[model samples]
Target: MSAAAPTSGPATGLLAVGAYAPPNVVTNAHYAARLDTSDEWIVSRTGIRERRHAAAGETSSALGAHAVRDLLTRHPDALEGVSAVICATSSPDAMFPSTAALIAGEVGLRGAAAFDVSVACSGFLYALAVGHSLIAAGLAGRVLVVGTEVMSGTVDQEDRNTAILFGDGAGAAVLGPVPAGYGFQSFVLGADSSGGPHLYLRGSALRLPAGTEMGPYLTQNGREVFKFAVRTLGDSAEQAMREAGMSTAQIDWLVPHQANRRIIDAACERFGLPLERAVVNLDRYGNTSAASIPLALDEAVKAGRFKDGDQLLLAGFGGGLSWGAAALRWWGGAG
Candidate 1:
């Protein structure tokens, strides 16, 4: 199935991109020193050697704000007409007052329409779709979509299952008008709530009984998640590509969520795309949840990898058993 033709509306696209990882680095050896795992075991499983950790008192908002600041620093006029700030984060600083609002305030966008999306690792793509729609509907001209995570705060340091696979980072993209036919072409989003039990963070929010006990940490059934992610990611990519009226051969880059090396390889193989056509950085940053795609995109852009008019496929899946994908024609220039 091919995607519907581009709709007639305000042409919207990513204008710029930026990312930030805290200075603190945690190597596999850091975990090996405490856990029963070694560097070879961690790398062979997750393809991660080192990951960043947020410093003391650092929050998702702070990490996201840093990314926005970086974007603004390079593209000083990025916020000239930005009227909305949407942050996708599962590790929010607090339950109230959205992390987007905090980031907007920090970036001097005090009165912008700001909010948060809690779709886990698929969040950035979700926020990107929302930002794209906002522009298409003329609700906002320029919107900042950020995916920030302090996963280090959520993972149990003692739980090797999760602790070894997550890192803290933030990535932001400024969405605005681009030349016609040069932005987002189509999007696909889906979820299977039954898979929710495979990954979750059980906390006191559910209001347990007086004596009920809960583990206040991110937990997961790795085998279940691996199975679900591999299938959903490939399907989501095909759906998004079809919706964009393109075939796998037309895709110039595949930017999947940086969850695991095996999952990424499987998805690429399913698409019949070579590994070289995919943007991957999980080896250095592990899984930064929603930040993965944009972080990799930013790195690729700065490295002069994407050319103008490149067809890019962005896909992700995460904790809510949610997955999303988008097809876009890149115009380059984003850093």
Candidate 2:
């Protein structure tokens, strides 16, 4: 079914993007030395050769702030009339004083409304939709959407299943009103709590099932998650495209969640999109949860891969068993 055309209102556009990754690089050899794995094995399985690790005392806010700072430096006008900051993160600095608040304070946006969205890797897209709606609703003229994750602290180093699959990074984008028919067109979002058991990080305050115990580290059933992701990626993207009145031939790029290479390849094949037209960076950053999409987006934008008026389809799935997709045109006629 096609998405209903949105009511006339301010059209939200992605003005600029930026990202940051810690300097400390953790290669496969580091894991191989401890776990029974090798560079070839890790690459073959996850397509990751190395990933960034936050240094001692670094926090998600710090990384996010850095990314925002980078964006501001490149496009100083991006924050003009900005009134809110929405941060998407699964690994937040604290339960209270949301990471968005911390990042806002770091970037000198003290009076802006600040909050956090915790939906694992799909969070950036969720937060983006919220930012877009806020602009359309006239509540905010512009919003800063940041996705940051410090997964190094969340993963159990001893667990080969997850340790080798995550990294730490942040990406930020400024969303503001663009010309008519020039920005975000439609979004498709969904969730299934039943898949929660397949991927989760137990929190101290969360109630557990009868025999379940709280665990601090991130946990996952890789096989189950892999199965869910491949299907959801293609399904979500297709749904978003349909809603946006776009077809596979009209899409210029597919910026998917940087989870697994195999999942991405399978999803592309199923969606009938060529692998070459997809933006992928998992080989270097691994899976940065909420940070993956924005990080890939920022990199691609900087590389001049996405031209004005390019039709882009973004899709992601993660821990909440949540999946989301957005169909948007690259920076177009409007400012």
Candidate 3:
């Protein structure tokens, strides 16, 4: 799927962004003590030194609400006319009542329409596209897009494959009208169901790949997923940029999903972008699933790395063997 240029009129762009990570830090040392691995081995392979684990009772909605509150505090009027809330996650607090609905209640969005997007790491971009469309279609004045995950809740502590690679966190953005030529340009998304066996959380409802059995934990073929992500991330970003009538030199930053340092490096190389041009934080916070891109975006925004009119390319690839990329022109002066 892909989005065309917005309808003629005001453009929809991110008004404000926010993120939150649980205080409980789980360092590589912590994993080393339990798993048959050392910090050097983990860091050299995944470039993750530590990750945040939500404390007991901290759910996805709670984390998302905190991120929304943080955004409100920074941009006090960002949500004044917000009419919808979109949450993207694979680790919802429950299967019913939707995480978006739960977050709306937590944040007092009493009458807002609420829903969820469950495309794993690519979910944030998917949610952003929907929010942008809602505003462009005049169905909403503003929309709050949130990506939150309590991945630790679904990870098997005994399994080193996923345990050392995931963390818990939330990131959010308030989408509303912006001046012409300074908002989202295009969004490109795609999926390959045949690759589902490469990375996924086991569930009874999903058909297994022959001998595979379902369980309550995340399972992955790390090598296979790494290959898929490296190719998909770059391909999606290029398609989005082309759709936006842009070239690589016009993009200022590449905010990619914080899955693995190697994957980011590979994707950047394939996209003809220097590694330093990419925003990364996986060393401090391993992949937070859907929250990865926004978390990195919020951090960069806070650091004042982006200036008005700067171009940005956001890309993500994960379970569902799905991928999404978007081209955006920054509008805000403040973080």
lDDT of each: 0.88, 0.88, 0.89
Model 1 misplaced regions, further than 4 Å: 1-8, 207-213
TM-score of each: 0.95, 0.96, 0.96
lDDT of 3 by residue, 1-335 (tens): 44434224477789999999999999999989999989999999999999999999999999999999988888988888999999999999888799999999998898899999999999999999989888878899999999999999889988888899999999999998888888888888888888988887875466776665587798888999988888788778888888888887788899999998998898777777788889999999999999999899999999888989989999999898899999999996436
> Which wins on TM-score, candidate 2 or candidate 3?
3
Best by lDDT: 3
Error of 2 at 160 (Å): 0.8
Residue-by-residue lDDT tens digits, candidate 2, 275-308: 9889999999999999999999988887878888
Kindly give the number of clashing pairs for every candidate. Answer: 3, 0, 0
Instruction: Point out the worst 10-residue segment of candidate 3 by lDDT.
Output: 1-10
Indicate the worst ten consecutive residues by lDDT in candidate 1. 1-10
- Which pairs of residues collide in candidate 1? 3-242, 3-243, 3-245
Per-residue error (Å), model 2, residue 77: 1.7
Where model 3 places Cα greater than 4 Å from the true spot, the runs are 1-9, 204-206
| Pairs with steric clashes in candidate 3 | none
